[model samples]
Target: MSRRARVLPGFSLSLGVAVLTLSLVVLLPLSALFFRTAELGWARFTQVVTSGWVAAAVRFTLGASLAAATLDVFIGLLIAWVLGRYTFPFARVLDAVIDLPFALPTAVTGIALSTLYADNGWIGGALADLGFRYPWPAWRGFDHGGWPIAWTVYDRIALAPLGVVLAMCFVGLPFVVRTLQPVIEDLSRDVEESAATLGAGRFRIFRSIVLPELAPALLTGFALALARGLGEYGSVIFISGNLPATEIASQVIVKMIEVNETGNYADATAVAVLLLGASFALLLVINLIQRAAVRRGAPG
Candidate 1:
């Protein structure tokens, strides 16, 4: 047999460069974070991470990120379907606009969101007037025996837990939309048509056929969005009101660095280590789910 020619020159050199860049930009920083946390000693690290305020922040951040990512799954699927299946005036423009969150500065997005959702601002004022509120009655019940399970309608969104969720959703939306777009585009309409011809309803076709095809991409998008939302700070801080045990996010660790009192650096780095571990675990779960979905969808 004849020898095959190489596809590209300098493959070794490019690989070396890529590895070096990744190490310098990503690996080194993460390694340093772990090293700093280790310096705190295991007992102290646990003490800091398990502190009441830190625990509260972690709970709130995790909850908000999950809620936002879940919301994005539906919104992103809708937008991707529209863009992939329909043609209309400004369709291209609308598609382009979906990436605005990715391109815009986090601070700018934070400021804009804060402005738009402030109590006196456009949407917030209307909601406030309608007497809307998001009451954690279950939490309240934990503290105070038996609170009524009434749903408070029309709560103001800004500077609340809702604001944190909104910020997360804003920043995470692009991840879901972008990840799912190509998958949606690549999906064939023939399968759907055949199902319809077999007397299947729209919902049945979507549930039995479309959903399986889209599952892996959807999970990947959700993972990416959730990861981003968990680490988000700039936009979240502006709207979250930074109320400890309420709207505070895990990124408050960064603020602790500036203060530096009471061994804040050690505490912050320890919290970071926990966040990193949680993120790794979550991503691993998502990857396993994606792989399972792909396997199930494959022809046996």
Candidate 2:
């Protein structure tokens, strides 16, 4: 038999291109972050990372990201299930529309969300009328109107921590929905039918069988959403008001360089290094859990 010509580059050429691309696009920029941090020396780097403002920003960013990812798991799964299993008018359009966030500019998303959630905006006005006003004073650690902690927390929905969560959810929704949709579509109906035939209730089957099968995909989606939320800036910036020691996000580290009185870049990069390390560690744990779930669900 005659040998057929290859349609693509050989392994050596392909590997070279891959490495070059990775170096240019990912490695070099990430290395710059570390290089800048190293210039600060150990003491200065630690001080920057341990600053009160940085701590507050870290807390707000991580808290909002976790909350948004948790919500996305439930909401995304429901949406994916409906789209994957049901037939309805404009269902395809709805599915496509879930990706609007991915396509829309982040600045535009920020502006729109800020407009919708601002005190004088349509949605914001109705929410404020319903007594959902943000507790600005409480956010600054003052007792406003003797409000309870719970109510104060609830009131901080717009231009506060909750606003950051909302923006995170808006940006992260597509990740969860897109991840889960395929896994949901690939699920075997026969397995569900067999469970039903065995007298298993809908909830029972869902909890016992469906959930286990979907766990890995769900975890993957959660990781993606959480990562996206953690790094989010533009959308969150507008809605959160970026108040220092209140609703500031981790991404504000970059802004620190721009706005710092001494024009120090090292402080910003030190914060970036810390954020990167924490994010990588968390992602590693999540990925391990996902892999374990996948292995557990696999047939021996």
Index of the highest-lDDT prediction: 1
Model 1 stretches astray by more than 4 angstroms: 1-8, 137-154, 261-263
- Any runs in candidate 2 off by more than 4 Å, and if so which? 1-5, 133-151, 154-156, 260-262
Kindly list the per-residue Cα lDDT of model 1 for residues 45-68, writing each as its tens digit: 888887767776887788888999
Q: Model 1's lDDT to the true fold?
A: 0.84
Task: Report the number of clashing residue pairs per model.
Answer: 4, 0
Candidates in order, TM-scores: namely 0.91, 0.90
Model 1 weakest 10-residue run by lDDT? 136-145
Error of 2 at 16 (Å): 0.8
